[model samples]
Target: MSIIMQYIFNGIFDIYSIQSNYYFFLTNLQLTIIVTCTLWALCMGYG
Candidate 1:
């Protein structure tokens, strides 16, 4: 039970860290560009 709790805690911590880093590195403009590029790629790939 304790191990399971630790695993869950670690997962939450990892997600928080990842999200923090993502926001820290990418500004609004960069995020918009990235999302646009990703969507364009997906559209091109699938359609």
Candidate 2:
């Protein structure tokens, strides 16, 4: 019973870490895209 609980807890922790990393990666990607688009627009002087 203890071993099963340990495995379950470990799995949950792993999943949490994976999700955190994915969120961080996605936010970074979004920020990069936004910055790139803003720069492109500024260069084109569409404003």
| Best of the candidates, lDDT | 2
lDDT of 2 by residue, 1-47 (tens): 99999999999999999999999999999999999999999989965
Looking at model 2, residue 16 earns an lDDT score of 100
In model 1, the runs with Cα more than 4 Å from the true position are 28-47
Q: What is each predicted model's overall lDDT from 0 to 1?
A: 0.94, 0.98
Work out the TM-score per prediction.
0.55, 0.83
Q: Give the per-residue lDDT digits (tens) of candidate 1, residues 1-47.
A: 99999999999999999999888777876988999999999999999
Error of 2 at 42 (Å): 0.9
Q: In model 2, what are the clashing residue pairs, if there are any?
A: none
